[model samples]
Every structure is written in structure tokens, then in C-alpha cells.
Target chain A: MCAAASSPPAANPDRKSNAGATPDPWEACARLEYGGDRSPAWSVREELLATPPEGWPAAETRLLKSLARADATAAGRAFLCQMLALVGSAQSVPALAALLKDVDAVESARYALEAIPGAEASAALREGIAAVSGSAKAGMIGSIAIRGDTSARYLLAGIKGNPSEPAIVREAAGRALEHLATAKA
Target chain B: MPTASTVTRRRFLQQSGVATAVAAAPLILPSGLRGAGAPSRKITVGIVGAGNISDSHFGPLLGDPENVRILAVCDVDRERRDDAAARVNRTYGNQDCKAYGDFRELNRRSDIDTVFVCTPDHWHALVAIDAMRNGKDVYVEKPLTLTIQEGRALVATARKYHRVAQHGTQHRSMKRFHDVAEFVRNQGLGRLDRIECFIPPNNRHVGATWKPEPVPAGLDWDMWLGPAPWRPYTSLGCHYNFRFISDSAYGQVTNWGAHYLDIGQWALDMDASGPVEVEGRGEFPSSGLFTNATKVDFTVRYANGVPMFCRTRFEGGGTVRFVGERGWLDIARNRMSASHNDLLREMQAPGKKIQLPLSNNHHENFFACVRSRQRPIADVELGHRTTTVCNLGQIAMVLGRKLRWDPAKEEFVGDAMANRLRGRAMRSPWALI
Candidate 1:
């Protein structure tokens, strides 16, 4: 559909005759688009997409990849979430929110939740709390308390330092609990 | 009807006669027309806009020795103005050239014979009118005026003041563009049916939000805004970002659309006329920084059965494509391609002529007319007509309705609501006259 609308002008001998008379080649090119069959639309899009991946900023590349797979499967969504987290795009919060309940992508969702900044990130954290289980939920609550506003105090109070948890997760929860306690005082 | 050979011979003879007469009479006419010997003195030229387009105009004007001398420069920002002036002075070795923070101060100088009004759309008319009133000719950037009424006034004022005003629609100066237009019109390219103009999208506005900030020091924010309604400063409201808003500028339609569409109109030989009807659909920002249409497809129909299609996001930057009964031609700034290699070869061949009273210099075209007392290549009427198409597209987007325009009367046909949009209410102390 996009290609047809942007198809280059139909080739004609007369247009060439006219353009050939032009003294400057650049001006001829400017006129050829209106007078020729070449679709500038297709060329512009092709050029943009052809730009090297390394040439694009990390955030732009992540956004492009996410948009490319926005309608893909749960695993695809998980991969996108992981990529978004790595780039630290606040733009990833909405994507993470949409994926929070997809059971296969819960761990990726947790990473996205941790990566989002400020209030929106805390909301994603709250949503992740109900969908994930055990240590993941505890970790999300600790992340929420650290990143969220005053409204997150109640979530902070629910974090219990279980011995079975990884040492780093336990330490993060302990620190969040201490911070929440200090805030209350 | 006269045969093609007879018409061509007659035109050549007429032009030759005029050229010979002009050479013989070396007198300056009252309407500020200069004959061949009017004066070889170089006129000093000043540049008003020191933004992205400074290089485009600066290089061409500085390179042409017959027309002008690099004199002074001005920008709202002192640093840019100084830098532009320094560059010109260094290149031309004219050490006494001055830099101005205010265009009004630059206009006060008697030594400056012409002013390049390359500022933003909002400032084009204001500076051009002021420059003319100050007895200086003007070469304004394209889309000539910000509003329909302003365009009309600029054209009228230029004539009334005997000032030579050239809108910077430089494609008119290109031989190839004239050939394309002539070929299409002459039936060498078959029947002209459809013309499409494209402006590609850039990422400057993607996921962007607008927040007002204090006007920075070393900038006159109000003057920069000019005739645009008073508003708090935002990064998006000035410089390269100004086109994204309706209040400050007309977005891409007039930004790049003006140039491409000007070429389209020129090719169609509609320099003194425009579409009778115009309509469009596009996505405008619902909130945050941008208010201009992000994506749009607009169609304008001329009285002569020609349709102009202008679209955004078909590619990037801007391009114009013409579709004729026999074939088509595609043109952008840097490239030209045709389906038939023969056509490209033929277009490049010599002896196939399209003449435009050739002047390799835009500023020279204006100065020659300043002396000749004749219209420049991109004359006011031509500028108004081309700019009207752009303004019509903008109005269609703003009103979100199909508008019927009377090219002869230069007004909306029985549509009072649309007609009202033909001009804007100028802010006080900045009168249109």
C-alpha cells in the first residue's frame, strides 16, 4: 500500500528532453521528481532504514526494534523488554505495563520495572507485585520503595528479608525497609 | 495559429530588440529602472537571518562579483550575527563590515543597498517591508510572507516604493526547472495530470514534550517571535524547532513545502495563479510541544485541470514528482532520476533551450531589475502566487475543510469563513503598511 502511493513518476522521453536542457544538474533533479516516475517516498524510507545500526543512537535503535516487534509473541515482547531496560528509556514503561501479566515474560517485566524512572516506574512495580511470586515480588517491592514517591510506603513495609533469598536481594530489601522506617519517623 | 518556428523567431527578435534598446539607452528610469550603463558600482548587501540558510545565500551572493559587496549581518542572537559577519568579512577581506543585534539598526545604515530577509516566516514580511521603506531592496526567503495579507502588502509595497524584491525561490533560476515546466506545458511531455510534493519526517519531534523556559540572555525573544502571538519561550518555539508550531510558523508545509511547491507551481506556469480548491487530512499533536500536522496528505486542484498532491512522511526532507500523460519526472534537491535513460540523456543535451533572462546570481537578478526597473525572476506576483498555495494548504489544515479559492480575485469564493483567513490581525505597533 505504501509503495504504490510513493512509486516514482512514469518514465517519459519529453521530461528528459526538458531536464536535459537545464544548466544545473541539482535543479534538474528537483524538477525530475515532479516530472519523472521515481518515488521519493520509497527512496527516503529506504535510506532511513538503510542507515547503519551502529550509526543510530542506542535509544533510537531500541525504540526501532521495539516498534518492529510491537505485535509479536510473548517471547518477542520479553526480548524487547530486556533491550529497553538495557537502554534505560522511560518510553519502555508502557510496554512493560502491557507485558506485566504475560506469564512467560515476568522476569523481563521485572527488569523493565526496575529500569523505569519515577512515578510511572513505581506503578509498573506495583503491577508486577501481583503477577510475580516470592523473591521477584519482594525485589519489585524494594525497587518500588526506592524509586517511588511517598505513596509507596505501604508497599515498602511488606518487604520481609527471607533467608532463602539471594544475599543482594535481601540486602536491598533491608535497606529499603530502613529508608521507609526513617521516612515515617 | 503561428507555426512553432515563426513564434520562436519572433520571440528571439523581440528579446534581441529589447536587449539592444537597453544597451543603447543607459539612463536610469524614474521607477528605479537602470539601463545598461546605470552604474557599475557594487551595492553593499546585509543578511538578516543567520540560521540554517545563511550559508545557502551567503555563498552565492559572496561568489557573485557583479552584484553585491558583503556589508553587514544581523541576528537576534549576538553570537550568530558576529560569527556570520566575521566569516563574510574574512572571506571578502572587507574588514569594516559590521554586525547588528537588531535588524532595525542594520536598516539604518545608508551604505547597505539590499537586505536578505532570511529570518523565520513570522519575520519575513516585517523585515522586508521595513527594508524597502528604508530604501533598500530585499531578497526574502521563500514562502515570502507569513500570511496572505502580508504577502499582498509586501508585493504592493515593493511596487509602490520602486524596490526590487526577489523571493528566494531559486529553482526558478535553474535552467532544468524551466525546461521541465516548458516541456510539460508545450505538450512535449504529454498532458499534465498530477503533481506530488513530498517532505520527509525527521526525529526532532518524536516523543518530544514542550515546556516553557525563561528567555535566554543575549536573545530578544519577543523580536524573534515578531508578529507571532505573545507566548512564553520554549525550546521548540525558536530556531530549527519553530516550524512545528502554528503560532510561530507553518511547520513543514511552508518550511520545505514552500520550496518544493514553488517549483511545482513554476513548472505548471502557475506563477500568477493557484489552485481553485484545496483540502487535506493530517495528524496534529494532541498535547505537549508540537501543534503542527505530523502526517498529512493534501490535494490542490487548479482551474486548468491539474491536481497537486502534497504529503508528509512519504520520505525525509522534501521532493516533488510530476506525472504527465507520456511520462513522469522526479526531482529533489540533490538527485534526479527517470525511468527511461534516454530522457535523462536528452535532458542533458545542448541546443534544447529554456531561457529565463538568465542571471547566475539571485541578488544580481534583483539589482539588475533595480536598475532595469523590471521584475526579477522570482517577482512579487510570482512569489505571492506560489506562497498562496502554501498558505492555502496551511489554512486547509487549520480549518480542516475544503476551500475554493478565486485565483483572479485572490480570495475565497463566497466562503466568508475561509476568506477571513486570507489575512491575519497584525499585532499593534507592527502595522502592515
Candidate 2:
């Protein structure tokens, strides 16, 4: 039974050093699995992160994994994306950018992208555009149009002949092209 | 514009005062009953399972001050128990109401006269039996029990206790539902040949890939699992999403199907009996999460040449379309449309014979039965029969084969393995006894 899975022992000073070194957040998340009246395990993690220990980066990455593992809401995912970006580890970039293509996390991913360094972030945005279809594509194009990026307009122009393209996508593409031409003028 | 009759002019003013006084009496007086200075009587009602559907019942039960007073609310979830208690206090202006995280504690309360078994399907039989044993009348929610054995045990317990048990099929009390059921049975729509019951698709996902989250505060996860084998806390199993799983619920078959199938049984006058032959086909997701069928079309044939068909997402939720030799009747909540208006008019005629009991109030009907010690219009047996039809449909879909059912014996005829599936082994400390 999933509920019967044994919870890890309470935090002991001796165990703290080993727990701090573990990179996966899911290991800590597994300890918090009982449902019903038990208080959330994330609250404890938040308290730990409030004043991070000496080995902060590994703990932060582990905490991000725990948040992602416990992703029940958009807000939680957004919080995880933000935390990963704050840690600024190159290893966290793929996990944060992965949120760019997740329908639930797209908007938060855009915010996290602003904090991401250079071409990797741009490449992630392009990949996110390619990954989305239907109404989601239009939303992506609208965001790109708002940023007023010429590269986004160029990519949006190439996404033709796909029937799945939403009306909003076509509208946003036209608006992006107009914004680009006007910027040139 | 106006010449008043001579007799009316003086008499009207005198009559108006008495009428005003009579109308005001119920409002102004602490107790509403007229003439006698008898103290107001309060019916003690206890609620089990303070989950989402509890609010649906609470609105009506607490709203009707004339008939009911919520005495106690119980839930495994401490948070929900407190929330329901607060709502009850706010609704009735009483602060002394009790709350219990264990239903057994609520059942043991001598103050509670009637028990509302609103818990998950698995807990229904145990709590209801305990309440009955404690000499409390019961108002159980639909799809009466989780399994056939549990249904049988519940009915047996009700009989042993000689308690009034009312299934939560509120439509039985509605005027329109009565008219539709009477129309089909009385041959107003001619000889009923086929009936179709529809339930909408459930898109909620389940399983390992659907990760478990941190358990919310003020919840008792261990108690929530109750008799079911323990599983890690997932929102999917706790709230409205519980319907998507097999462990806690029977999926849509018992949830939405219970509502529609009750109407079908009522229309067919098969409250005591059900279809003998059951068969069906369905589509399940190939992978990732959901286990219950996405779409299913099932048929059950009664001995008297009537066949009832159930389709998931064929149209929408809780819909019943009765096709007769002449015309068909389609009815859902608050909407009853027919192929022929004349048939509907005939059903509405004065002195028309309908088997439905005259009780406009669902809660009141249960309360009345509690006092009078009579069977409600929808009794335990009727609920079991209707739920059996639903269970049969699910069995057919799961087995992908035809079934022969004996409603008299309440067993699948000639299939030992299928017969065994009718009941489940309860986890320890949650015995049906």
C-alpha cells in the first residue's frame, strides 16, 4: 500500500550532513506521503530553506526536486521554477526550461527565462513554441509579440500550413510582423 | 373603479387581522406550532463523511429548521469535521454541536436519533450497520454500498434493527420524476420496450505517474483510508477525485449510474427485481493514470421483455431516456421532455395513479418514516436492486462477457469466480460486524 510506505526518521543532527549532500528532492518528498490529517512535508522544507545550511546549493536543488515532486498546483510549480532560477546552477536550467513547455507552468517559465543566461533561454523559448499546438501556440506567439523579438516573429512566420494553428496564433503572428515592421520603420 | 359590496367592507378588516396574526404566529413564536403551547421538538441528525457531498445535503438538512436539527457531524478528516461543525453552528445558531473524527463515536451518541451515512462507498455498510444497531434510523447516500455483499449485509442489518432506512435518491420525492415514472409504468407512453441511461465521461486521472503531494495540515490521512488498504496521500483519492478509482469508489458506474439507474428501476417497477442478463462493451485508456472505462455501452434484459441500456458520455450526466411502444421520455435534473405532449398531459391529469409516495421533502420523508416507522418510497431493498444493476454493468464491462444474474438470490448464476467478486475483504479493525 502506497500509504503504508515507511516515513524516514525525524531530522537528527547526525543525519543532517548526509541529507544535505543528497541532490534529489524526491528522496525527502517520499518521507511526506501519508494523506488525511498529516501536515505537509513541504512546510518543513520551506523552514529549512528559510535559513539554508553551509552546503546551500545542493540543498536548494534537492528542495526544488521536492517541490516539483509535490506539484499539485500551478503556484507550487511556479515556486519551484523560481527557486531553481535563484540557485543559478547550470544543472537546474534544463529542469526550469522544461516548465516552458508545460501547459500549467508556461507563464512562470517565461518569468524564469528572464533570469536565465543568454542563448540557452532563447533556444528554450523557440523549443517551447515548436512543442505547443492549437490554442497554446497562440498564447506563446502573443507572449513573443509582447516581448517584440524579431527572432520570435521570424519563427512564427515559418509555422504555416498546420491546421492545428489557432486563430489567435494567426492574429498574434500578424501583430508580431506588424510590430517588427513598425520597429524597423 | 370601485364599489365595494356592503358585506365585505366591515368583514374584510376583521378577517385580515386574524389572517395576519395567524401568519405572524409561526415567525414571532419561539416554536412554530400553533394553538398548543407544547414545547418545540428537535430531531437529532448525525452526518457521516463530511466531504464535498456533505455540503450538498447540509444545505437542505440545515435549511429546513421546521423538520431537522443537525446534532453531530463526523469525518475522518479533522479539518472537514471542524468545517462542517462550524457551518452547522452558523446555520442553526447553535454552538454546542459535537464533532467526531471517528464515525463509531458519532454512532454511539445517544442524542443522535437519525444517522446520515455520507461516507465513501467502502465505509457505508459498516457505519450504517453500527447506526442501525444503536437504534438509529439511517439516511444513506446513493449507490447504497460498495459491494453486493455489503448491500446484503446492510439490508439484513436494517431488517434486524427494524429501522427506517432511506436511500439518498432525492428525485424520488420530486413531482416531475414521479410523473415520468408513472407515465412509463402506467403505459401512458405505451408498452416500454427499451430504456437508455447516460453518464458523462470522467476525465480525472489516477495511478503512480500522478504523483502524490504533501498531505495538507489538519487532515487525518490514516483514518481517511479507513477499511481500504493504505495508500500514499494523493488529492486524487481524498476529494471529488475519489470517484475515478476502484479502491474507494466504483467509478462512474456507481456514482452517476446509481442516479439514472434508480429512475430506470422506478419506471420499470423493478424496485425489488432487476435484469437477468447483463452484457456490455467499453473503452479504457491504454496507459497513464485512469483505470475506469472512458466510454461504455451496456445492456441488461429483464425477464418481462424489457431491456435497459446504459451508455457513458453518450449524451450527458444523469439522463434517462425511456423508449416505449409509442413515444419516448427523456428526463434529467429539473428537465423532463417528451416526444408527445399529450402523453405528458395524460400523466399530469387529476386522480392519475402513481406508485410514488406523496412526500415533497426528501429529508422530511426520512424524518416522517423515523417517527411513523414505515418504509420510505425508496427503501434499502430498492436501493440495493438499483445499485445491483449498476454493478452488473461494470462487471460486464470488466469481464467483456455476458452474465446471467438471479435477482432473487442476488448472485451471478453459474459463475463462481464472478460471484466472488461481489464482496471484498475488509482491512483489519474495520470489520463489517
Candidate 3:
């Protein structure tokens, strides 16, 4: 069976797929770099390079929706995250925020939300701190600091002194609060 | 309005004198117990950020006989994650390897004992800190952190958790660099007074407008920009090229700087600390997605009166040239030379004083230390100090002034503006602390 088409592109199938046909060169490039072997055909990278690096709103939403599909492979979701970093905006925040609690999607979701510039993106990340813990919580705090969102100062101050929180979290909160205080300065 | 508000805040900080103290607090390591159930018989491994650099590590790591297992791979790019995991399974002739789109999943596993942090500079802090907090040793690529504060937090976390962390200034493990650093330190070049370090501008060239592009399949663009400020992606703005943009990295200053500058620190006997003052000026692209300097020139001074001038130009294909009372010595990636032709012969005789730590391979050193629990050559503190040099140079470049750094405090000397730039504020879901 042709594995590439067996699961519709929109379906975003699981990592384990029917094995006969080769994935599209774009997907292949991602695979080649991620695995032990790099240097797939130059043609694969060029296929991506060929796409003009502008005006991606439509594709961004479509890919975000694709995450819910049962067929979504780890590679496919990761790929979507990468693209979102380039094209994502406040509109992409809700989808990314929802994944803030998902262990597998949290980092990429945070990555997308972090790079997006808007109050809504900041809100989602601020909200994310409550939903996640450990690394994910630390990551959300890091993103809030990166955004320079001073509105979270009170929230961050609370975390800095919150004894029940992990030491890493408190440390991150202190660092972010300093940034907000200094950035506002 | 921004200027007014900023001035008011600055005055408040300056009047109270409290913020500086908070920023300059000692890097105390808090108590953190190791995670339970870490594999004892074999070191379980995972990979994060499977980019081109991943190739350099995977071969050496995956091939370690009987003691190493590549159990999982994670990356924002799905294709890379799945493919990398599949490849690992293929190498071991099994289908047990797991693919994760989020590094947190890799961080959550008590079974995996180590993680290869091959991500971009910006993601290093969160990923490394999280893994250490969860009880995994890390081999993180350099400039260890994108900002000085991030480096401090990571170092504290490593110490607090008692994890063996290796920063990816691989030159520490190479014999060529080790040989020269030892010779310079041992007075082979006589009383060292000055050293000149150099690297290429590495800005390359590209157009400016950072408009959004069509999000590609099999790539998570958002995850790629983790913890960095939001900007619409241009083709050149993402991928390995993120270095050019000041938002994600400090260009070749940190890129090439992390490797060669590290060697300088080792030679100058300043690995445990850093320069006391830094002043620099360089050419920045007037308009583009990249904001780091193109033609770099920076000068740093140690407390010992040894001055190191760093530049981005070529003189004899050299990475650094150490000048001493006897003569001068030059060393680069491919070759090394000295004022006296016989200096090489004398140094190679093997009874040389001050023999530096030796590790012929970076990957081997890291895994060896994992078992022994000894600090690798490029340990977290060493990595932090070296990266601090680059950050200082870049900070001075941006501030357009000579800034005195209190290396003991790891903060600028009363310069709130420069101090503030030490690290950036994160947006959400991420903080460097």
C-alpha cells in the first residue's frame, strides 16, 4: 500500500503507517535530519525552499486543525509546530494553549505561542502556567518573560515566592520578574 | 510614553538600589534529590532538536557497545522526530524507540538517564533545566544558553540536582586544541601578556521583510521559535540561520565564539571566571531579520592585566594568537604555529608542565563522566563563563559603550541598561529562571 496516501494528509496519521511508498520529499527532509542519517536528496530541501516564505495564515490554521486528526504522526505534529513558529499569531494561541497540558505536544505548543506577538498569545501562556507543572510550567514562565508581558508581574511575583512550587519554577519566576521589572524600567 | 515609563522605573530601581542586589544574588544551589529508578546497568539516551548538528553526536553515541541505548527522540519537527526514532530503532534492530514532538515527554521519563540537547540556543535553558530537575544528565550544545541569566539558572539547577552536564564546546575534547592550550598555559610561549581571538562575520547575506510564509507540512514552526519573541518567519529567519537574528542568538560571536573563545579561557587560566571589562563596536545590518553585528571587534580585560582582543577577521587562519615575553603562538581549527619554529618540537616532548585535562573525543568524555560522575572537560560552569564572554561582547556592542562587568557577581557594574540585557523576558509558558 502507498503509505503516503493511505492516510489522507488531512488525517495526519500515526507515526506507524503502512510501509511501501516514500513520503513526500518535504516530509523526507524532516525525517532525514531527525534520524541518524542526514543528507537526503537536495531536491527535498529545495521543495521547501521553493515555497515563498510569506503569507501563511491559511496554512497555519489548517495545520493546527490537523493536530486533532487520529492519523497525526509525531513527525507530522512536530512539522506543524515548526511551521507555526514561522506563521503563527494570536489566532493560533488557543490550539497551542490546549496542548500546553499534553506531554508530547507541550514544548512545540509553547514554542509556537512564545514566538507569537499579541496579548492573546501572552494570555494563553499566562494561563498555561496553572495547567502544567515541572518542565512545562518552567517553559511557560520562560515564555512569559520572553514576551515581556508586564501584566503578569503580579502572577509571576506569586510564583517567585510560592513555596509549594518546584525550586526550578521559583527560580524561573524570579528571573522572569527581574526581566519584567528591568524591561519595564 | 515608553521612554517616560522606562525613566521612572530606572529612577525607582536606582533610588532603592534593591534590584541590583536581587540580580547579583549568589548562585546558591537548592536541595534537589535525584529522580528514582534511573537505569543503572546501561545509560538510556534520548535526543532533542534533531537538526544537522545531531549527525555529529548520534553516530558516536549510538555505537557505544552494551552501555548505551537510544530510547527516544524528540523535536518540534515531526518528520525529524519520527524518522530519528525509527533510525535509532533500525540501528538497534528493534522497534522500541519512541518519537515525541515535545521535549517534556523526554524530560518526564525516569527510565532515560541522559538527553542530547541539540536544540537552537534559545531552547537550551528550559530543556536542560527541566531534564536536570527530573534527574537526567545532559550533553547540551553551546553557547550553553542564549542569555547570561539563563546560564546562571541552568548552572544552579545542575548543581542543585547533582547532575553531570556537558556543554557542547567540543574543542575541549580535541587533542589539537588541548595541546596548544596546555603549551600556552605552561609558559611554552613564555609569560603570556595578550591574546587575539578571531572568527568570520558569519552574517552571510539576505533580504529583510519577515512576513509569514505558508506553514510547511511535517514542521512545527511555532515550536521552532520557542521562547523567542514573535516575528513573522521568513525563509532565512528559521532553521540553522536563526543565529543571525539577535532574538534567537548572538551570531558567530557565540556560534564560533563558544568553541575558540573557550580555548582562550583554558589557556588564560580563567576557566572558572571571566573578563572584568568589555568594550566593542561592530557593523549591524541596517535592515533585515538578522540584528547581530556583521564586522565584529571587542576587547576584554582580565583582573590579571592580560588583555584579549577579539575580532572577526583573518590573520594566518588562526583562532587565537597568544603573545608572551618569549614570543607569540597561533592556533586554528586545522593548524597551530609559533614565533619560534622549535616551539612545537619542545612542546611535543611530553614532559610539559601544567598538563591540561585530556579527552580525545567529546562524546566519549561525556558518556564516561556519566558513569564516573565526574565533570566533563566543558562542564556547566566552564561553559557558562565562556558563553558569558560572548554575551558581554554582544551586550557592549549593542550598548555602544565600554561596560565594566563584575564577573564575581555576573552583572554589569551599576549599569542598569546593560544589566537588563543580561537575559531577556520570556513571553509565556517559558521563563529562564
Candidate 4:
């Protein structure tokens, strides 16, 4: 599938959520996976989202559960990850962390994890250090770098020194290493 | 439409230290709309860069049948250029739209009334200046120019020629952002204190070494390196990936900062003047094919004691926030919000809400200005000023010290090193000057 069609709701939300008293983010998101015609489902997600961010606990719990689902598409997962990237926290890490091995969602998952401030997101990326390979591996390493996670020095150093790994990943490791060092300075 | 004032243009050119500009021919209104009564036709366009970003523009322009007539496509990459031209021809159901390996050929065509400079940031100055000098209105991509000198020259030259050059910072045309900027500008936030800019760096997938790959077929490697230092062919060093390489551009500092910082400046009403001092920390790679600042925590301070913190996206998370005594307002591409709900609710409390000149579509706004001769939402000079903040921020990060800036003069106060960094020695056979 092309990148753009991978998920419709990520780019255009209103297409899914009909204008109402409250627009839903999840229903807007679910309309991506299920269909825009599933108006009632997205309405709940939107209604929950309308509870103001301070009252988003119910909304947050539902999103985390959706993220935790194993049946999620990379595009579907990325849509969720993008939303969470804005408001997610330590509690959102485990569900997102489980996807680091996901060849498709790794980038989006890492992006969400990267933005969620704290030791947990960094810890999640560092822990996924061994599980991911290819672009997923490279992406996680870079995300860890963007997070300025110095704790990954050992992991990054190993990748930087690895001869057999692809140049892209090794270069990313090297760059991430420099980032960690400079951030410390 | 603001008429091209010849006397003022000459004086401004002299003041800008441009010895001479291309003596542009008299303005020719698009044949479609001339005299008092002519059937309006599509504004003729020559798309100058056929990369992925340029492709994004195709859909919108093609969708708006009223505005687009892509007369030609040009790129250093032959295959890409032909592909773009083919798309245009396909959309128009004709093979009349031509393709060129050089942008100059595109600029030379009198039939084309407007030009879109969608090349790499480094190529922005040259392509836009060439179009302006040739008397074609331009819609160039952001960060508008790669250097301070390029920016100053572009602003002066655009005026000297009286071309409607829209700097490609799209958010300026978006209603949500215009709302936030107008709010902060009109003091809805009460006594604007400081603006905090948070932009993340980008990592284009170029490998770590200078190991050159063979030049790809149908690609003019030297032409692609136009005005930038020449190096052996690397796929990553070309196309959209070139943003990560500092020699060609200032990386994400301009790439993303152009969006976020432009919002910051727009809200602060600081497009005409910028931060008096810039300082902060940035981390560059010691050895890599890509060398833009990977880590930055820059602080740009305005003359009014309002200090803006330019930090990693993690700090405030890829948005621009205006903080003031009453409250704060935040703007991101996805969201625009205030610190308190009541502030946003009570925004229209009579003379409280400021309404900026309106624009909701980026491409249409440019086309409209081209027809009207009025400045677009993101005019060349305004775009230059916003980009100047980004360029100066990157310069400060690279130098690792606070440097004084003379925004009025568009120069560094006294730092010799910083002054030199304003412009680069373009590779021979390609010149912006």
C-alpha cells in the first residue's frame, strides 16, 4: 500500500468524524481502520477526546489499549502513535514499546516514544536496542539519540563499532553516540 | 497591486550594495488577463525542482484548474524533470508542457509568467533571483535562502524587479496559525514577554563516510551541486536528502525551524527586526556524510529584554509558544491553543482579537498576489526576515557563542567569523552573484 493511503484518518480527521457537539480523535482514528461510515464508534472516541486534555484519562486508557492490540496495522499504529506523541507519557510506553520489532510501526512507535519525555521512553528504546534490525534498528537508535539518552552509550558504541552491520545503521549509531556525548557536554 | 517603483528600487538596490541588477523588461501582465476585458486564463508556471516536495505541490495546483498551467518542468535530474513534465502534460491531456535539465532555460521562457523554485535550500537563492531578474513572479520554497547575503540580495532584487516572490512557508497562509499570531501580536496574551521555539532536528539517511557512489544515470551531478561546494556523487547528497548536509543547507534548523520560527516571528511582529543577540549550544557530528547540527538549545534575545529559548523539540515539543504576563499561546501545525481556556474564549472582547490579513490556502494566495500585485501572505522580505532568525540561530550554534546581530543592517555586530559565515564560496561554474 502507498504511504498516503496506509491511513486516511491520520491526514484528514473530519472525513471520519461528522461535525457534532464534540469531535472524537479515536473515532477519527478508528475510521481509518474500520471505515468512515462507522460513525457511532468514532463518535465515542471523539466524545471522550472532548473531555478536555485534563480529563483525558478515559481517552488515554482506550488509546493505550488500541496500541497494545497485536492486530494493528503499521499505518493504523502510526496514526495512534502520532496522537500519543503529543499527549502520551510513561504509561503509554509499554504498548508502544511492544511495537519496536514491528518493521512498519517501528518508525512511528519510536517517534511517539521519542517525544514522550522521561526515563521510560529512553529506557524503552534502549531495551529495544537488540530486538530491532534494519531501518527499525537504525530508526530506534536515532530516536534514542534525539531523546539524548546517554544511557544507551554502550549499545550505541557497539553498533558504531560493528563492521558487519549496514552502513546506515552503523552511521546512525555513530551519530547518536556523538549526540549523546555533546548533549552531556 | 503595488507598482514597481523605479526610483525607490534604484535607491534600495544601491543601499543593499548590489552594483547592478538584471535590467528587467517592463512588466507584462499574463496575456490571459490584460486590458479591461479579457477572458482570464491560467497563470503560466515553470516548476523548477521536480523532487518529492515539488510532487506534493502538483496535486494542489492541478486540483485548482483555475490557477495552474505548468508550461515546463526543470531539474538537474533528467528523469525526474521528464516525469514532472509528463505529469503536467497528463493532467492537461497534452504534450505541450516541456522539460529542461537547467533552470535557466525555464527562466528564459517569456511565455511563463510565474516560476516555482522548489529546489534544495541552497539552490533557492539562485533560482528565485534568476526568475525575479527575468521579471517572472516567483513562489520559492523555504527556508527562503541559504545565507544572509542571499536573503538580502533576494529582497533587494525582488523589489528592484517588482516580482511577486512568495516565500514557501505555508503556515503563514493557514487560518489556525494566523489566529494564534494575530492573538499574540494584538496582546491577547497581554504584554508579550518572550517566545520559546522548539524544533527537532532531522536525520536524512546518508551514510557516515565520504565514500562516493557512481553518479546515477540521467542525473546531472554537477548541476545538482549548483552553487554548493562540489563533491563526488552520493545519492543522499542529492534530492530531498541534501537538507542534512550543512554545506548545502543548515539542516533542520532551517528545514523545520522555517515553519516553527517563522510562526514565532510572525506572532512577535519581529519580521522587520529580529533578536538582537543569539546564543546557545548545538552539536555537530565530528565525522559524517551529514553534518547539520544534531543537537541545539539556542537562545535568541530581542532588544526589549524578551528572550526566546530555541530548544530541542523535546523541550516544548515542535511548536512555538508565546509567553506573556497574562498568559501564553501555543501554535503547532496540528494545534493552536492558549494557556487558559478563558483567554481563547474571551479573545474577541472588543479590540482584543487582532485580525491579520487573511489567507487560508498557500498556493492560491501566491497566484492571487501574482494577479493582484499585492504582497502574498509570505512575501519575499517577510520570509527573508523569518529565515534570517533561523540562519542566525544556526550560525550561533556553529560558533558556540552569543553573537550580536544588527537586524537593521542585516549583519553581525563585530564578529568576523560570524560575518564570513553569512555567505559561502560557491563552486565554480555555478554562481548566485
**Which wins on lDDT, candidate 2 or candidate 3?**
3
Candidate maximizing lDDT: 3
lDDT for A83 in candidate 3 is 53
TM-score of candidate 1 on Cα atoms, chains taken together: 0.63
User: What TM-score does each of the candidates earn?
Assistant: 0.63, 0.63, 0.67, 0.64
Q: Best DockQ goes to which candidate?
A: 3
Question: Which model, 1 or 3, shows the larger TM-score?
Answer: 3
Docking class of 4: incorrect
lDDT of 4 by residue, A1-185 (tens): 01121332122232223333336445345334311232333344334433445655566677777666656554456557655665577888887787776655666677667667689988998998788776567767766775667778988899889899888688778766865776653
- The best-first sequence of candidates by lDDT reads 3, 4, 2, 1
lDDT digits (tens) for residues B1-433 of candidate 3: 0111344422422322222212212222322333222224566888898888788878877776465788889988888888888888888999988998889888898778889999888999889998987888899998899999899988988887778788999988777787888888888877888888888766777334355577678777777777775545567777888899887889889988888888889988787799988877655553345667777777788887777877888444338888889888788878887888888787677777576766655765566566545566778998999999999989876655566899898989856556656765453445654
Model 4 Cα lDDT, one tens digit per residue, B95-133 = 999999989889989878889988988889878987887
**Tens digits of per-residue lDDT for model 1 on B354-396?**
4233433355456665555556777777898888898888776
TM-score of 4: 0.64
Error of 2 at B238 (Å): 1.7
Cα lDDT tens digits for candidate 2, B1-433: 1112333423322332233223211111121211111223456789999987777889988876765678899987787899999999987787977889888798888777889999888788878988987878899998898888778878877886677788888887677786788777777777787888888776455222455677788778877776564456777567766666656776778888888888889888788889888876655443233446667667888888788888877454568888887888899986888888887778777665554444454665566455445576668888888888888887766555567899898989865435645765343235443
